[model samples]
Target: MYPGVNMDMEMQNVGSNGSEAAARQMATTTGNGEGHTHRGPQSAETGSLLQAQCNGGSVEMKSDRRVLALRGPQDSTICRMQKELKDVVCWKIPLWMLLLFLLLIMVAIVFITLALCPVFHQDVDEKFDPSTFNISRLFKGNFSLLDLPFSDDLLVPSSNQSRALSRDLQGKLTVVYSSSPALSRYFSKAEVHAFRNGSVVAEYRLTFLMPEQQEEQLRRFTLSREMVYNVLRQSLHQQEDHGTYIDPLSLTLV
Candidate 1:
């Protein structure tokens, strides 16, 4: 401790003591006593970790240099921005691309839906019609009066307008004017009158027998009714005539 006695050794000892003291002070200030201080900055730091001490490693005990560790606003801001930029650069591109791709897919789906909306149709007539099948008949001549094969099979009459009289004819004919399901009653009691050359013979009733469903027969009966009425009108003189409205037999389908 004498002035400059063993000067070099004393200086070396003092330097070591100061380094130990600074290390202890840093450990205390950082609150890193529990093994954390061992991982701190290396000996290359060369300066005191704490502020208020000047010459870096060692100058003289009392040098005039003032130690100040000041980070300006610009430097602090730049460090924070660098960390944030690194995070975004590492993870944002794929996420943004995924969002854009989803949006494009949704737009394409909407456009496709709009383009294909007008291609649907639904109006069909499902009723079975005889005209849909190709068959023709002439019922106004003497050939039709010959005893048809249908004479024996007709079930006499039916209940509920008409019932299971002819299972064979049920699906075969489109019965137009029927108050009953069985044509058996009409076939037995109805009459036939024929017309030729726009002139009809006087009305005569004939039982025309049929084995098959005859929509054509019903149409023929209707035509006969009209022709007979007109021929009768021609026969009577208007001054002496009283009108007779013959009731066309009403037929119904079951």
Candidate 2:
């Protein structure tokens, strides 16, 4: 071979070796830059280093380096941030919806209770007056005395002796008239009075036993005007002494 050809071949070999060494150095620098470039501020430094290396490098190699350097860390960071934002949104949306749903349910319950609940309004009589009412006006009349047949002097019993005369009269009346077995339970007390015609008459008052249902039964089944007159006539006749006379035509009930 000629001396010039040998020299040209040697220069080509040296240039190819230099290009290989530059590519190796650029690759090493790109790896180190990727480790350091974690944020946006560090990207400018990495880009500046790659641009400086690309000043003498091939166009395709420089473009490939730029693509690799920008794509690796930046895309990974952007994707991670997007995923975190999506997760935050997912958590917040459900929480807000749940709170709104609970509030709506509470509102619905209150509305239903108010709508369905009953309202009572009591009616008052406009003509009624409480202060003008008198209880004593109801008992203005006196009880009528029943005239009964007798054979003995019928003395008037004193009204001030509590219940002694009344109880004795009740026992005599119950024992004399046996047609009614439970008649004694109705006679609460008796009052005696002397008339101008020398006639003594008795007025018997009634009282009901406890539990008002029993009182209703007694009033319905046991009490009558005729029955009272017969019982009083028989009872008085049994305790007579033949000195008194009772008129049967004067018998009346009040």
For TM-score, the strongest prediction is 2
> What Cα-based lDDT does every candidate model obtain?
0.38, 0.47
**Could you give candidate 2's per-residue lDDT for residues 1-254 as a string of tens digits?**
59999999999999999999999999999878985665465565555434223422322224324543323455667777666545533446654466567899999999988876744433343233334332211001122223533223334344443244346545554454444444443433333333222343444443323224344544455544445556656555554644323344444444
| Cα lDDT, model 2, residue 100 | 68
Q: Least accurate stretch of 10 residues (summed lDDT) in model 2?
A: 135-144
Candidate 1 per-residue lDDT over residues 1-254, each given as its tens digit: 56667888889999999999999898787775554546445532544343442322222322235544454566667777666545533345544465567899999999988777754433343233434333322222121111122322222233321233223123212121122233223333222232112111112233323323544665466334453333323332221223222122211111
TM-score of 1: 0.16
> Could you tell me the lDDT of residue 18 within candidate 2?
100
